[model samples]
Target: MTTFLTFTILGLVLGAVYAIAASGLVLTYNTSGIFNFAHGAQAMLGTFLYWQLTYGWGLPMWLSLIIVVGVVGPAMGAALHALIMKGLRDTADVTKIVVTVAILLGMLFLSQWIWHPEDARIMEMFFGAGAKVEFSGVVIRYHEIICLLAAAAIAVGLRVLFTRSRVGVVMRGAVDDPDLLRRCGHNPDRIAMLSWALGSTLAVLAGVLITPVGGGALEANALTLLVIDAFAAAMFGRLRSIPRTFAGAMVLGLAATYVAAYFPTDWTWAGNLRVSLPMIILFVVLIVLPQDRLRGAAIRTRERYRAPTVRKAVTSGAALVAGVFLLALLMDDTSITTFGLGMTFAIIALSLTVLTGYAGELNLAPLSFGAVATIVAFHFGITGTGLAARLTPWGVLLAVLVTAVVGGLVALPALRLRGLYLALATMAFGVFLSNMVLRDTTEHTLFGVTFSLFPNGTLIVPPLQVGPLDLRDGRTLLMTATVLFALIAIGLVALRNSGYGRRLAAMKDSPAASAMLGQNLVKLKFGVFMLSAAIAGLGGVLMASAGGSVAGDNFHIMASLSLVMLTVVGGIGYVSGALFGGLMSGVGFTIIIGTFNDLAAATPPMETIFKSLGHLAMVATALIGMGVGKNPSGMVHDLFESYRALRNARPVLIGGAAAQAVLYVLALTGVIGNWWFAVLTACLVMMLPVFGRMLAPTAVRETPLELVGVDEPYTPELRDRLDRELGLAPALGGDRHAVA
Candidate 1:
C-alpha cells in the first residue's frame, strides 16, 4: 500500500507537468487552428535556454528562470507566429502541420549545432552536477515538486485568463472565426500572436520544470518529441477546452508513471507500453471521438481540378527516366551509385504522394510499413527456409502482397476517422511498430534451429552477364532496382490518371459528393492505402537488398518522419515529386555529408558552418516548398509543362541542357570544390519546376481556387448555399443542411 501510494504521488506530480504542457497545446490549437507539431521542440528550447542562462552564463537561477520562462519563451513563440504560422493561416491543415514540423526540424538542427548535448553542456546546465531533495516517506525530489507546482499555477492562471480577460475573449473569438473578428475591426493576428506567445511561454516552463526530473541529456529534437503525449492530452480535451486538456494530461502522466513503477518483467514489453501509453490513448480518443466535435469545419474551399493530360504526363515521365538513365551512365561512379539509393527513396515518396496528395489523407506510418516489410524480406532472404526462399521470385511477390494486406489492415480504423485523429492513429501505429514490434531483439528459432538473418547472404536474383557487361553486379543491381521500381511507380501513376484515380480525387474534394456520386469511401480509402503500402513495401524490399541487411535502427521513428519531410520537400501531389523528394532526401543526404567531409578535411573551420548550413538549407527548402505551394504535384506538374513548352523551342532546350551539362561537369570535377557548388546544384534542381522558362510547357494546367469556382465571395448566405448544395454539415452549433 505504501509503494502504491508513493507511485501514485509520483504519477500525480508528473501528471501536473503533462497537464501544463497540454494546456499550451490546447491554447495554440484553439487560437490558431493549427496542431503545431513543433510545440515539443519549443518546450525543449526553453529548457535549454533556462539551463544556458543559469549555468553557462552564471546568472541567478531565479533570474534565469524568469528570463527563460518569461521573456525568451514568449519571444520565440511570437517570432514563430509572425514568421511562419501567420502566413500559413489560410493554408490547409496538413500544410500547417508540415510547417510546424519544418520549424521543429530547424530548431532541432539549430540546437544540435549550438549545444551539442553529447558534450555535456545540457547536463551541466540543467542537472547542476549534483542536486536532489527528499521529502515524506516517498522521498520526493525538488525538481518534480517544482514541475507540479508550476503546472498547477499555469493551469489556474489559464482558467482565470480565459474566463475573465478581454484578450482571452478576443483569442476565443479568433479561434472561432478570424474573418468575423476582422470584420468587427479587431486584429485576429494580434490575438494569434498573443496566444502563441503565452502558449510558448507555458511550453518552455514545462520544459524547464520537467528537465531535472526527466534528465538534462535531452537533444532539442528528441526532447521535442515529448509533445506527442501533450498532443494526446489536447486531443482528449477535444483540442478546444482547457479544463479537459489538463485532465487529459494528468491522466496520461499518471498512467505513464504508474506503468513505470510496475515495470513489467514480461519480455521487456512493458517498456514499450509505458512509452506508447499516450499514443495508445490518443489513438483511442481519436477513434472514439465524434469528428465534428473534434475538428473545426473545413477551413478552406475545395477546388475541382482536372487531371494532367495523359500525353503530357507520359512524355514528361519518359524524359525524366531518360535523364536519370543518362545521369546514371555519365556519373557511373560511387556518387551515381549513391544516387540510385535516392531513386529508391523517390519511389517511397511517390507512394506518399499517392496517399496524401491524391487521397488527401496524411498517412504517417508508411515508412513503418516499409521497415517491417524490409525486415521481413531480409529475414526470408537470409534464412532460405521460409516460403520466400523456397519460392524465389514468388516469395518476393508474396512478401509484397502480404505487406499490402498488413497496411490495409492497419488502415481499417482510418476509414471512420479523418483529419488530426487519422494523423495521430497512423503516427501511433508507426511508433508502436518501431518501439514494440521491431525493437524486439529476441532471436527466433525455426524448426529447433536458431537462425541469424542479415549481412551474411546473397538474397537477390543472381547476377547476369550480357555481352561485355555484368548486369548482376552491385552497381548494376542498384541501377536495375532503380529502373524496375521507377517503372512500377510510374505505372501506378498512370493508374492514378485512370477512373480509380478520378474517384480518389472526387473523394478528396468532397466525401459527401463522392458518396452521392456512388463512390464507396470505405473501399476506396482502403484500396488506396493498401496500394500505397504495397509500393512502400516493394521499396523496402529493394532497400534491404541494397543494404544487404536489416537492422532495427534503419526503421526508427525519426526515419519515418524524414520520409514525410522528404515527401513534403519534394512535392506531395505528383509521382515525379515523390521521385524528386526521394532523391533529394536519400542521395541528397549522402552527397551533402560526403561533400562536407571532404571540405571539412581541407579547411576544418568550415566544417561546423557547412553542417549547420546544410541542415538549415534542408529545413528552409522544405518550408519554402510547403509555404509557397510548391507541393509535389504543383511543382512537378508545372515543371513538366514548362519543359514541354521549351521542347517546342529546340534552341532553348539545347542551350539549357548544354549549360546544365557544363555545370554538372564542373561540379563533378575538382573545378568547383566548395560546398557552395553542391548547394547551388541542389537549388538549381529544385528550382527547375518553379521557373518554367527553361523547361517544356505542360499541357496539364493547375487550376487555382479562383478558377475552380471556389473564389465566389464567401458570405454567410453563400456558405449556407454551398453547404446545402454539397450536403456538407456545419461544425459545432450550426444548422444542418437538409438533404435535397
Candidate 2:
C-alpha cells in the first residue's frame, strides 16, 4: 500500500502536467477551431526559453517565468494564431494538420538552430535545489506540489471563465460560427486571440512545472513528446470537455506509471512495452473514438482532377524511358544511385497518391508498410539473412502481397473515420508500429508461449534478383527502378482512368452521396488500402535491396509524416506529383543539399547563408505542402493545368522536362567541366523558359464589381463588420450611396 501510494503520487505529478497541457489543447481548439498539433512543440519551446532565461541569462526564476509565460508565450501564440491559424480555419483539414505539424518541425529546427549541439545547459527546480514533503515512507517534492497546485488553479480558473463570464460565452460563440459572431457585432478573432494567449501560457506553465519532475534535464525532443500524453488526454475529452480532459490526463498518468512500476524490467521487450503504453492507448482510443466528436474538419472544397489519356501516358512513358536510357548511359555511378533512390521514393509517393488522392483517406502510416516489407524480404531469404537461399522475386513478391493484406486489415478500423481523426489514427498506428516492431525485442508472451517477431537490431539484405537477373550493380539497379517506376506510373494512370477511378472520385467527394448512389465503400476502401500498401512495400524492397540493409532507424514514425508532407507538396493526385516529390525528397534533400553545402564551403563569406538556405529544403517543402493542402490537388496539378490552359506554351513544357533531364545527366556524368558548378548553373538555366512564361504579358480583362446595396443598419459597427467580413480595403471602389 505504501509503495502504491508512492507510485501514485509520482504518477499524479505527471498527471497534473498532462491536465494542464490537455486543458490548453481544449481551450485553443474550442475557441480557435485549430487543434494546434504543435502544442507539444510549443511547450518544448517554452521550457527551453525558461531554461535559457534562467540558466543562460542568469535571471531569477520569477523574472524568467514572467518573460516566458506572460510575455514571450502569449506573443508566440498570438503571432501563430494571426499568421497561420487564422488562414488555416478556412483551409482543408489536411492543410490545418500540415500547418501545425510544419510549425512543430519549424520549432524543432529553430530550437536546434538557436541552441547549438555543442552547448549544454541544466536547470534547477523552481522552489529550491532540494525541497520535499514526506509521509508514511512516501516522499513528494515541492515541484510536484507546485504542479498540482498550478493545475488545480488553472482548472478552476478556466471553469469559472468559461461557465460564468460573458467573455467566455463570446469565446465559445467564436468557434461555433465566426461569421455568426460577426453578425452579433463581436470580433471572434479577438476572442480566439485571447484563448490562444491563455492557452499558450498554460503550455509554458505545464512544461515549466513538469520538466523538473523528469530529472530537470531539458532536451527539446523529449520535451516535445510530453505533448503526446496531452493528446491522449485531449482526445479523451473529445477535444472539447475541459473537466473530462483533466480527468483523462490524470488517468493516463496513473496508467503509465503503474505499467512502468509493475511491468517486468528484466524481460527483453518489457521496456519497449512500457515506453509504448501511452502510444498504444492513444492508438486504441483514436480507433474507438467517434469521428464526429473530433474538431477541425478541413474547411475546404473537394479536390478536382483530370486523368490524362492512355495515349498521352504511353507517349510520356516512352519519352521518359528514352531519357532515362540516355541519362543512365551518360551519368556517373553517384548520379545513377541518387536517381535510383529518387525513383524508389517516387514509387512510395505513388502509394500516397492512391490512398490519399483518389481514395480520400489521409493516411500517415505508409512508412510502416514499407518497413514491414523490409522485414518480410529479409525473413523470406530475399535479402542477406545469412540463409544464402535465394527465394528472390518470389519471396519479395509474396512479402509485398502480405504487407498489402496486413495494411488493408489495419486500415479497416479507420475506414469509417475521416479528416483529422483519420490522420490521428494513422499517425498513432505508425507510432505503435515503431514502438512494437521496429524497436522490437518482441519477447512478449501469451499463454506461456513466447512470440518474438523481430530482433532489435539492423537486418541485412543482399542484391535484388529475379531468377537470373542480378541487380547488384548501381547502373543495373537504376535501370530496374526506372522500368518499375514506368510500369507503376502507367498502371496508376490506367487505374485513375478506369470505372474504379470514378468510384474513388465519388467516394472522395461525398461518402454519403456515393453510398446513396450504391457504391460499395468497404470494397473500395479495402482495395485502395491494399494497393497503396503494396506499392509502398515495393518501394521499401527496392530501398532495402539497393542499400543492402534494413535498420530500425530507417522507419521512424516522424519519417512517415514527412513522407506524407513531401508527397502532398509534390502532388497528391497526379503521377507527375509523385515523380516530382520523389526527385525533391531524394535529390533535393540529399544530393542537392550535399552539393550546395560543398559549394558553400568553397566560398567562405556566403557559407552560412547558402548552407541555411539549403537546409531549409524540408521546411520549404512543408510550407509549400500547406499550400497544397489548401489547394488539395497539389502544386504539380496546378502547374499542369496552367500549362494545358495556355495551350500555346505546351511546347515549353516538353522543353523544360527534356532540358532538365538532359542537363541533369550532363552534370551527373561530369561531361560539363565541374559537376557541382554545372548542376547549379543548369538548374537556373532550365527554369528560363518557365520564368519567361510567368513574365510574358498577355491581354486580359479584369472583372469589375458593381455596387450592391446593403440591407443592414447603416450604423458604424455594421459598416465596420461589412468591411471586415468582405476583406475590403478602406477604398475598394465602394458604392457612393453606401459610403454616404
For this target, which candidate reaches the highest TM-score against the unseen true structure? Answer: 2
**How would you encode candidate 2's per-residue C-alpha lDDT over 543-588 as one tens digit per residue?**
7777776677677765666667667766677777788877676566
Pairs clashing in candidate 2? 93-298, 384-462
Question: 1-740 in candidate 1: lDDT tens per residue?
Answer: 66887788777876787788888888888888877777888888878777787778889888988898879998999998887777765455456666676677667766765776676654432345345455465566566666677777888888888889887888888878888999999999999999999889888877776665566466665577776567888888798788888888888888987888877576456886887788888888887777762232355532122355557566766777676665554454566556656666676776787888888778776677777566565555333433332223544566678889988887887677776667778887887776666655555577998754333322332222334544334567556656665576567567768889878877776677788778898998899889888888877766655554456656666666666766665457766667766777667666766766676677887987777666666556546543533242345554555555544556654555676777767756757643555566666655554454444454344334243445443445555555554558753334422221
lDDT values for all models: 0.69, 0.76
Cα lDDT of candidate 2 equals: 0.76
Task: Indicate the TM-score of model 2.
Answer: 0.86
Window of ten residues with lowest summed lDDT in model 2:
699-708
